[model samples]
Target chain A: MDPSRLTIAQASAAIAQGSLAPLSLVDSYLERIASLDGELHSYVLVLAEEARERARALAAEPSRGPLHGIPLSLKDIYWTRGRRTTAGSRLCLDFVPAEDAETWRRLEAAGAILLGKNETHEFAIGGPDFTLPFPPARNPWNTAHYPAGSSSGSAVAVAAGLTAGALGSDTGGSIRGPAAFNGIAGLKPTYGRVSRRGVFPLSYTLDHCGPLTRTVEDCALLLQAIAGHDPLDPASADRPVPDYRKALERRLDGMAIGVIRHFHEADAVAGFGPENAPNPAYCAAFEEACRTLEKAGARLVDLRLSPLLDYADANRLIMLAEAFALHETDFQERPQGFGRYAFARIGLGAFFSAADYVEALRARRELCREFREATEGVDAVVSANATAPAPKIDTVPLWGVFERASYTAPYNLLGAPALSLPIGFEDGLPLAFQIAGKPFAESSVFKVGYAFEQATPFHRERPPIAASLPGRT
Target chain B: MAEPIPPDRFTVLVERAGLKLTPEEFEELREGSRFVERMKESVRRSGPREARLRGVTRPREKTAEPAHIFIAGKD
Candidate 1:
C-alpha cells in the first residue's frame, strides 16, 4: 500500500493495530515535504525534530488512540507553545504563545504530531501578498494559481499530500475556498462547534476553526479530534460533542438538496463578460453532476436567495469592525508590524463608526432569517463552489473577493455548516460543489459529502503542479 | 463612490494605515475602494439587527464553580 494514500481512518486503523510505526509515518511526510515543498512553498515553518519527538513518544506508548502519531499542519493563526504563527505577515513574526490553542491541545492529547506552522493570508484577512516574509502558498494543482486564503497553506499543504490533514480557520470561505481551489474536502462546522480560544480572530462573529483533508472521512476524523466546548471561548457553544466519526456512515438517501441559481442568474445577467461567467464547460459539468446526484437517489430542487453580494457585504463589515476592534491597540502602537494589505483592510474598521457596524448587523439578522427560511425543508444547499476553474494567481483582481458575492459567503452569514467537495473536473482544472447544512448539521453535511466522495474519483487526481517547480494552472 | 476617493485622502488613509503606497499601488487601492464601497453598501443592506462584532456569552447554566478566571483576550 502506498502509505501516503491512506485516509485518516485507514491510517488510524493501521496505527492502532500496530501495523504502522509513528516515527516512520512522520518521517515519510517529512521526506515528502523536503522533496516537494520547495516548489509549493506552502509552509511558513517546518518543525521536523518536534514532530519526530512526538511520533517517537506515541510509538513508545502501546495503546495510543486512532489519531496517534498523525502528522498535521497548523494554519499560522493558531497559537502554538513555541512556534511563531506569522499568519503570512511580519507583524507576528516575534509573537509566540505560552499555550497551544485548544484544538492543538486536544489533537496532541489524542497523539497527533505537529508537523509545523503553515503560511496563510496575513491576520486571516490579507491575501496572497508577495511582500510578506513568505511567498503566498501556490496551489499544488497549478502553482501559478492561488490555493486561496487565509488558510492558503493549510489547503495546499494537505492537497499536495505534504501532511495527512491540517487545521484551518474560515471566517469568510477561507477553508472552503482553498479546499475548493485545491480540489480537496473541507468542513466548516457551525460557528461554535469548535473552540477558537487560541486562534487569532478575523471577525470573532464569523470565524470558525475546522479541518481540511482530501476526504470527508478524513474531515470527520479531524473534527472528532477538534470539536468540543471551551469555557474559555466566550462564543463557544456548550453542546454535547456528537460522535462525528460515526456520523460519517449516516445515509444521504432521500435528502433534499437546493441548487441556488440566484447569483449565477444575476451574474450572467450582468454579463460576466466571457472571461468570468461560469465557463460553459463548467456549467454543463455542474448540470451533469446534479443529474448524477438525482439518479443516485437524492432530491435536487432549484434554490435561490437574495443576491449573493448582499450577504458578502454584511460579512465584510462584521469581520472588519470586529477585527479592527481586536487590533485597536496594535493599530495605535506597532502599526508597521502588519503588512500593507492587512493594515489597510483591517484599518477600515477604524473609519467605520459603531453605528455603521450595528446597522450592518441588523442587516445580517435579516439575511440569516432569509437564509434559514430558504433552507428550511432542505437538508443541504448545493451550489457552485467557484464560478469557474482556478484562474492565474497574478490575475486575481484586487477586488476579486468583493466584486462577486460568492456562493460560499451566505452560509458564513447564517453560521451554517458548509462542506466543499470535489465533484468533477473542467479541462484539467478541478471543479467542486458547495454542500451547506443547517447550523450544527456538520454530521449531515459530512454524511452527504462522504457519499459523494465515495461515488466520485475527483479526489484521486493530484495536482500536476510540483512544489519544486512552478507550472501555470 | 464619490468621484473616487481623492488621491489626497488616499494619502491620508494610507498614512493612517501606515502603508507606503507607491504611485501604482495607490492608484490600485483607489480603484479597489470602489469595490470596497460597493461591498460596504451591500452589507449595510443585510437587514437590521444588533452589533456587527459578536459579543461574549456566558454559559447558560454556569458551573457551581465556573472557571472564574475568564481567559483574557489577546488584542
Candidate 2:
C-alpha cells in the first residue's frame, strides 16, 4: 500500500503487522518526491539510491522502533554525512559533514528511512527568499503562498505529503511558523529536550530540535526516539525519557489552557489585525478553531503578553548576535557567499555589544520565568500559529523581518515547549494554533494536543496538491 | 546585577561579535536593542540568586509496573 500520509507511528505498526511492506512504502515516497518536488522545491537534495539501500536493509530486519521503515525528511540545517546542507544559501552549498548530527544517529537507530534533505531559510534565520540560489519552497496548499521558515521545506514536505514527517529545529518559530502555514503539526520541545550537537546553530542558547508531523502521536513517537541525554550536546537534557507515545493515550480531563490573546487582536504576521491584515477570512477561521478546541476538552483562559513586535525585536537581536558569532569569520572573509537575508540579519549581529548579547540572554531568562509562572496552573497555552495565512511568495519583502513580531518568538524567549497543530482553513489557506507548556513539559502539551486532534477532523483533510502525486492518497 | 548593554557600545560589540553589516544594519540593531534592553531588565531581576537557570532536564525514569504502561489498542 502507498505510504504518503501515514504518520510514522501508524506505518511502523502496519509494517510490524505485515499490513504494509517497508520497501513498497519507501518507493511510494520516492515516486511522490520525484513527481511533486519539481514544483514544490521542498528538498535540497534527493537521496534516492542511499534511501533505497537503507530501506532494503530495513525490509530485512524486524521493525526496530516506532519510526521503523518510515520515510522522514531532514532539514538542510541539520548536518548529515555525505549530504550537502546548503541552509538555503550558496555559502554552504557544497559543505558536507563527516559525522551525523546526534539526532540523525538517533533517528537511524530508530530505523526511519531517509527521504532526503529539506530546504531551509539561510542559516535558519532569513527565509523563503526567491533571491537565493534555490527557489524558496512554497506552501503546498497554495503554491503561490508562503511556507514560513527556516523549517520551510520540512513543513511543506510534511504538508504536501512528500514524506511521512520531518525533523526541524526551532530557535524562534522556525519549526512552528512553517507548520502553521503548511497545515502540519510541529513541536518545539523544551529548550534542551533534544540534542543540538549536529544541527547548525542559529543561536546556541536558544536553538531547539523537534519534529514536524501530520499528527501529535507522530511527534510523540519521533520525540521518543530522538530525545535523551547526549554527552556531545552541552545543552542536552539528562532527564529520563518518559513514555511520550504512551502519554498520548492518557486523558486530558482536567488540563487548563491559557489563551495568549494579544497577538490575535492587534498583531498580524505582516503588522495589522484581522481588519487591517491581508487575510481577514483566515483570521475568522483561526477563532472558530480555538472555539472548537475549547469545546473538545481544553479549558481556554484569556492571557496576554507584550506586543509580539517587542518579542520579535528582542528575538531578532539575539539571533543576530549569536548567528553572527557563529559566522563572524566567514562573513568577514567571504561576504558575497551569503544569501541576502542571511547577510542582512546575521550581519546585524555585528552591531551587538557583549553587553547587548548578555542583556538579551538575561532578558530571555526573565521572559522564560514570566511565561513559566503564567503556566503554573495551566497544562498548556493556546494562540494563533500564524498572524494570518501565508503571504504570496514573490511579494514578500526583504526587510519584512522588521515589520512585525511573530507569535512563535515568545516561547523562544521563555525556553518553553510550543507545538503548532492544524486547526481550520478558509479561502484555500490553512490556520493553526499553538499549545504551549511549561519548561521541559512536552508530554503534557502533546497529551492536550493529541486529545484535541483525536476529537477533530482537521488532520484528516489533505491538501489538493497531494492529489497530483502518484498513489499518494 | 549585570548592567544592560549600553546603546553606545553597540558598534564595538557588533564588530567584536564579527558581523559584517552595512550602515543600515547598524541602525536597525540600534533600534532593535531598545526592546532588547527592556527584556534584559526582566532576566536580571529574576527572583533569587540560586534560581539556577542552567540545569539539564530529562524524562522520568520508567518503573517495573507492567500492563498499565500499555493500554490495549490505545497504543
Candidate 3:
C-alpha cells in the first residue's frame, strides 16, 4: 500500500494492527515530498532525517495514541525549538526558538512525528509575495494559479499528500481560504480553543491555531491532540475538549443548518460585476450541498445577520490595528526588513487611530452578538468559503484582500468554529463551503461537515498534478 | 464617504508612527489609505439599525462593552 495516500485514521489503524510500520509510513511521505515539493514549494524546510529518526524510535516502542508516528507538518509561524522557524520572512531567516510552541509540544507528546515546516504568508497577514524569504506555495491543482494564503503551504502539503495533516494559523480566513482553494479540510476552531503560546502573533484576539488535513476526520484527530487550556496563553480557553471523533459518527438527523445566502449571492456580488460574482459552479454546488444536507434529515433554514462587508471591515480594522501594535518597533527600526506585501499590508495599521481601534472592537462585540442571535435557531451555519476557484498567481492584486468581502472572516469576527471542506470542482480547481457553529461548539460543526463529507465524493478527489507523480499511479 | 487624509496630515501620522518610507512607498501607502478610510467609516457608523435604515440613527448604549475584557491576575 502507498502509505502517503492513507488518511491519519487509516494509517493509525494500520499501525495499531501491526500492519504498517511507522518508519515505512514516514519514509513514504519523505519520498513524496522530495519528489513533488520541488515544484509545489509547500515546505520551507523538510525534516527528513529527524522524521525518520522519530519514526524508527516509534517503530520500536508501543504506540502512544491515534497520532502516534503520524507525520505532520506545521505552518512556519509555529515555533520549533532549535529549528529555523521562518514565518516566511527574511527578518526571521536566522531566528530559532528556544522552546517549541505549545501546540508543537502537545503534538510531540502525543507521538506525532514532525515532517517539517510549511510556508506561510509573512507574519500570517501578508499576501503571497515572491519577495519574501520563501517562495509562496503553489496550488497543486494548477501551479500557475495562486493558493490562497497565509496558510498556503499547509493546505498545499495536505492536498498533495505530502503530509497527512498540518497545523495552520487563521487570523482572517488564512486557514479556510487556502483550504477552500486546495480542496482539503481546514478547521479554525473557536478562538482560544487551541493555545497560541509560542506561536507568532498576528492579531492577538483573532489569531487561531488549527489543523489542515485531507479529510475532516483527520482534522478532528489533529485537533483532539493539541486542544485544551494552556496557562501560559492568556487567551487560551479553559474548557474540556469533547470526543470530536465520536461526534463525527452521529448523523445530521434533525439538525437545523442556517444557510447564509446573501453573503455570497448579494452582498459579495453587489459592486463587483457578473465576472466577479461567485462562480456558477460554486453557486450550484452550494445549492446541491444544501439539498444533500436536507436529504440527510437536516433542516435548512434561511438566515441573515449583518452584511458581509460589515464583518470584513471590523475584522480588517481590528487585525491591522493589533498587528501594527505588535510590529511597531520593527516598522520603526528597520522598515526595509519586511517584504513589500508585509510592509504595505501591516503599515495600513498606522492609519487607524486609537479611537478607530476601540470602535472596531465595539463593533465586533455587536457583530458577535448579532451572529449569536441569528444562529440561535440553528445547530450550525453553512456558507461559501471562497467565492471562486483559485485565480492566476500573477493576476492577484496587491490590495485584493481588501477589494472583496470574505465569507470566512465573519466566523473569525464571531470567534466561532468553522470548517472548510470541498463541495465541488470547477474548471479542474476546487470549490468549497464552510460549516460554522457557535463559540466552543466545534463538535456540532464537525458533525455537519463529516456527514456532508461522507455523503459526497469531493473530499476523495486528488489533484491531477499529484496523481501524475512518478510513483503515484 | 470620508475624505482622504491630506498629504501633510498623512505625513504627520507616518512620522508619529515612526515609519520612514521611501517616497514611492509613501505614495503607495497614501493611496492605500482609502481602504482604511472606508473601514473606519463602516465601523464608526451606527449599529445594525443604521445598516437596515440608512437615514435612521441611534445612540450607542454607554454600557455596551468591547469584545475584550480585562481579567485581573489570570496570568
Order the candidates by lDDT, highest first.
3, 1, 2
State in Å the error of residue A280, model 3. Answer: 2.0
Per-residue lDDT of candidate 3, residues A1-473 (tens digit): 78888999999999999999999888888888988899999999999999999999998988889999899999999999999988888889998999999999999999999999999999997768988878889999999999999999999999998998999999999999999999999999999899999999999999999999988899999999999999889888899999999889537888999999988888775532245588788899999999999988899999987767778888999999999999999999988889988999899998898888888888899988888888888999999888789999888888888886688888888999999999999999999999999999999988999999999999999997666346543
The DockQ-derived docking category for candidate 3 is medium
Regions of model 2 farther than 4 Å from truth: A249-251, A266-283, A468-473, B1-75
Which tens-of-lDDT digit does each residue in A1-473 have in candidate 2? 45666777778888899888878788888888888889999998888988889888888997687778888889998888877777777888778889888898899888987889998888887776667888889888889888888898999898888888899999888899898888889999987789999888898877999999999998998888888889778777789888887778434667677887657666543232233353566567667766766676667787755455545555766777788778878887888787767776666566556765655555554555557666777877887766567889887766555454477887886778989988778677778889888877888888878887887788877889876454345
DockQ of 2: 0.11
- Backbone Cα, N, C clashes tallied per candidate: 11, 8, 0
lDDT for A387 in candidate 2 is: 59
lDDT of 1 at A74: 94
Ranking by TM-score: 3, 1, 2
Best by TM-score: 3
Best by DockQ: 3
- In angstroms, how far off is A198's CA in candidate 3? 1.0
